[model samples]
Target: MTDSSAPPPAPAGPLSGLLVADFSRILAGPYATMLLADLGAEVVKVESPAGDDTRTWMPPVRDEVSTYYLGVNRNKRSVALDLKDAGDLAAARELARRADIMVENFKPGGLRRFGLDYESVSGSNPGIVYASISGFGSGGGASLPGYDLIVQAMSGLMSLTGEPDGPPYRAGISVFDVMTGLHAIIGVLAALHHRAETGRGQHVEVNLLSSALSGMVNHTSAFVAGGVVPMRMGNAHPSLFPYEPLPTADGDLIITAGNDGQFRALCEVLGVPELAGDPRFARTKDRTANREELRPLLVERLKQRPKMEWFHELVAAGVACGPINTVDEGVGFAEELGLDPVVTPGEGDRAVPSVRNPISLSLTPPSYRLPPPALGEHGAEIRAWLAEPTTD
Candidate 1:
């Protein structure tokens, strides 16, 4: 057997000394805490004996590990605790009481019975930054399970996706859950900063439905300001023409000619300068109004060239354009652009790569220090820590 008394490894990033008790399951909560872990936080993921549900959500498993589980769970330790058991519940509470931050995605009142709720833990650990993520708000919607699909359906997001005449479609990815997790991270960081200043903490709440609504950007604004519920326009932009993905000889290319100058440049590159000056397409509003008449012309021009050919020419001409690529292609493209999109976790095999956090903080860049843990892998270590007497 390995030497169990070896010192825990030192952290590599700025959040080196922070301890995070992650009592979340599935995507959103785990994702938020995983991001913190990536930045060098000591995240102790508390799972039920059955493990995170995503561990079983797979057809794509690597070495018997579910891709769904691997994707959001990097750089953390795991400790299984059956909260239903009094001993386990006490251990979980102790973990919370000692942690710098506590993250949970339990349904409203779900952990109250075990006294693991934020209110209960914060009652003693007043400095704990308690973050709760839910599907919807914890008010009237507290009891509802916050699935990404359900939130996408209720947040009017589905209605604004897909083709104009096609049924509402969910985004291929759980974008709402991802966004909610990101929002939660932002809130937690902000709360942590506040705590550092005042030596006090407060509850931070994030819900998928609210996050989805906020992420709607101008779509939600249009509805609120003008009573215009945005409808799906396929790959087209509601306010801009020639801003949609067009089919080319080889594949689809998105030509994002957002402004008049880009429109002129795009038209020039397409060998259709006259179209740029045409009375019907001279300005954004004009182009938007004349989209039906102009679309066929643009599509015909685009079809004559391969996507890469137009992509290169348009980008050279100062018009924003590129191929519509799949996830694999997107990752490769980011790599080509010198983004260094992937990072291998120090503790994981090559297959379990962690994507770098998009935020680039010059003073404190996020780092991938540890791979995701096996289920309850840190149970004994965490239990030992919890069993120690509190000094404060």
Candidate 2:
């Protein structure tokens, strides 16, 4: 007979039936694992006795819980263990051996002493898709700490942010860490595909600095391929005229013209179609090079209308523009567009409002069965599960 009190099985998803041992903390590793958990992987988050560091990153809290911690950690179970303790170390190792995937963000050699490193874990769990996140590669930079702000500075991202005359500033969020996490996920998925065919697994490594350079895209390309180091131009694009926010009657509205057609369309909407054929602004390169001369002409027309009126008219006329929005306004805009950006996970009082995962799968979609857990919330149950003898 079935045990009526037993928990119901996890709802089906694309990654259903997969077990992921997540031994990572903070942004990058936790963010990747949380996404995997959302996709229906059975994620077991192994935390130290003190729990993930973000747990204490308070001030913006929900029910006195850290919203920062809550932001990236959902749909996973937590099991706290002190690797210094023999029993906890055994449990962690056992979980790794049984896991189909394992993720960690320890220093390059930090996990070696605990026997939780890829070499040791993969020896027993040959099919494990092991992912390691670091601030830098496991080269000379390995000795250096891997913080997102540090990466933003060292990777030249800060150099491209802020105004030309202002000091370099890090992005508002941990962008490189998030990018590294995404890169780690791509690596894990690819390695999993390879393992399915070959029945062997490999180590996947991602670092913040590398991900930052890659994420910077065109700016990095400008330097490497063109030997031109891109610099901060405030809200302006280095290669496009009328791409930055311009003054309106009441406020500012961002405008962009990536091609001749868009520039023509913009000029038409501004009731200055003659400017489209002006020798100083007819072509994209010419407009970019002569932006200073072209700016006053466009601004004169833009300043005649309120930003919202211009927003509707420009959008209707097939020109791209929008008002600068706060985060709440951004979410409201998505909601107004029927995007359904927010979701509440868990049940009853434990339910926490979170941003919905951005992916859309027609077949097996993401399922949120658990909220971000309290410290060691699943310790007993997970420990019992790991202690059981495996038939494999």
Candidate 3:
């Protein structure tokens, strides 16, 4: 038997024997299942006949397929099942029965009528680790649709973003959705461990709003713990001075002097070492308190060199800094640092490029045995497996 404190090692990868019934759609649920699949779980993505909504999310397309869908659906098999149909409902229930874990993002109580909710499914599979993702909690915000932008606004992330005097702006990415998905992954993994120890699975619930609030970290703490509602500081950090992007002769550079030493080094690079000892800016806290008074002085010296030139100089001088990079340049920088940020999920010409799984397990690293599936690509096989006498 495996160690009681942890789930058994996967048959191939870290989670190889795990079977994930993914009855979720869009970003949050799909993203969570993809993480499990990367760890060697056999994830069957159960979708409506229309498929995932992201499959139709278009514009940035490759091979005529939605890159949005491709971005998170990798390493999983697709099995279309419409819950409204009796036969399909039976198939879905059977899939759930066989699943070691089940993930869903349906509205609160949405799956209860179909007998596919956690209560219903766990009736047959007592050891199933069931995870539910939602826009908000099931309590009062059940009806409110959970979208990243809405969460960003409601959870006060938008309030903390953008210019102090301008209207709040949404982040360039669906930050809350991704964060909630990651939280789901964490919950599922923990529940899996519990199941391994006691042979009893449990429900894991994560909401976008809650995740957003949690993701805000210091900002939220400022409001809740310190009785300070953090306002937008734009590119500047509210807690730290010299933490935002600074202009150079050619372009902008992101310079972060996080500590007194780094701040002193940054001053030295700007040929103003004496400024480090100045009473108004001698300490990190003092600098933050007097950043308005210090910004002009730093900007004047920063404009002497190009962004990249200053980046190298400051970095070498032990002050943390970098030039602002576009998405492609970011990837190139990762490559230059041997981070290997991208991976092709499978072999052959049809394999699509994807961001590599961030985890690095020495014993059982994540595998890329399969590319993302086409719509209903594994329907026949999955249905046949569900029809087996005892999938358990």
C-alpha RMSD of each candidate structure in angstroms: 2.3, 1.8, 4.3
Compose the digit string of candidate 2's lDDT tens values, residues 1-392.
12233246555888888899999999999999999988989899999999999999988999999999999999888899999999999999999999999999999989999999999999998999999999988998888999999999999999999999999999999999999999999999999999989999999999998899899999999999999999999999988887999999999899999899999999999999999999989999999999989999999998998999999988998888999999999999999999999988877789899999888888877877778999998888899888889899
Residue 287 displacement (Å), model 3: 0.5
For each candidate, what is the lDDT?
A: 0.86, 0.91, 0.90
Question: What is the Cα-based TM-score of model 2?
Answer: 0.97
Worst 10 residues of 2 by lDDT: 1-10
| Candidate 1 Cα misplacement greater than 4 A, ranges | 1-12, 347-351
TM-score between model 1 and native: 0.95
Q: Which is better, 2 or 3, measured by TM-score?
A: 2
Q: After superposition, how far is residue 8 of candidate 3 from its true place, in Å?
A: 23
At residue 278, give the lDDT of candidate 2: 92
The better candidate by lDDT, 1 or 3, is: 3
List model 1 lDDT by residue over 1-392, tens digit each. 11253234543677878899998989999989888876778888999999999999987987888989988898788889998899998888888888999999989878898888888999979999999999888899998879999999999989988999899999999999999999999999999999999999989999998999899989999999889989888877889998888889988888887889999998888899999899999999999999999989988998997899888888889999888788999999999999999977754254367678777877777876556678988788778877878778
Ranking by lDDT: 2, 3, 1
